[model samples]
Target: MAMSRNLTLLFYVTLLLIVLTTNQAESLSSQLSQPQSQSGHSMYGATQGSLNPQACGPRCTMRCSATAYKKPCLFFCNKCCAKCLCVPPGTFGNKQLCPCYNNWKTKRGGPKCP
Candidate 1:
């Protein structure tokens, strides 16, 4: 009889532990899936990201390295990356990162970047 009681107690303890661990894992995954930012607009603005240079690097490089137009290319690319929070792939032509940066037009209706 004493052995049966100990077994029942151990079973309940194991069940409680499983329940607690499952709940904790679900909570952690939910937190990870959402993006977080401090500033209300511009930096992240529900579309772009904050001042994450690492995230902006590839996009900026792809854009700025494509041509002899160095100063303006980097300037505009960085500005767009800051606002859009992404850059496309190659060094010549790709707008996959941020469509806002891609579809954006110049005053004369020309492509803005090199």
Candidate 2:
């Protein structure tokens, strides 16, 4: 009877270990797959390259603006006129002009530039 009990306890322990290990693996995988955040935008990583232009959000428009200090700046436009401009995270720019861009670079590995 004692031997049986011991064997049963060992079985339960093995089962518990398997369950714990599986749970841990799943959690780790989920973390790896999840997108990192940068300047209120999702940042996959440096290896993933720049974010798509469409992903930049509705208020912003990314283009090669002559008025922008940076070659490519996120322009806030209203109809025909551009109200504001901001550089991407990886690119360099001033605090006043590229607030979001600066934030993205500091937080994420690279800017959400397209």
Q: Model 2, 65: alpha-carbon shift in Å?
A: 21
Per-residue accuracy of model 2 over 2-109 as CA lDDT, tens digit each: 999999999999999999999999987866664557563434222122344344443233333334543334332211112113233333233333344333442457
Q: Where does the lowest 10-residue lDDT sum fall in candidate 1?
A: 39-48
Give the candidate number with the greatest TM-score: 1
Tens digit per residue, CA lDDT, model 1, 9-100: 99999999999999999988765554554642222222334336666655576567758887788888777777666555566555634467
The best candidate by lDDT is 1
Clashes of each: 0, 1
- The superposed Cα distance between candidate 2 and the true structure at residue 71, in angstroms, equals 34
Candidate 1: where is the Cα deviation over 4 Å? 1-54
- Local lDDT at 47 for model 2: 17
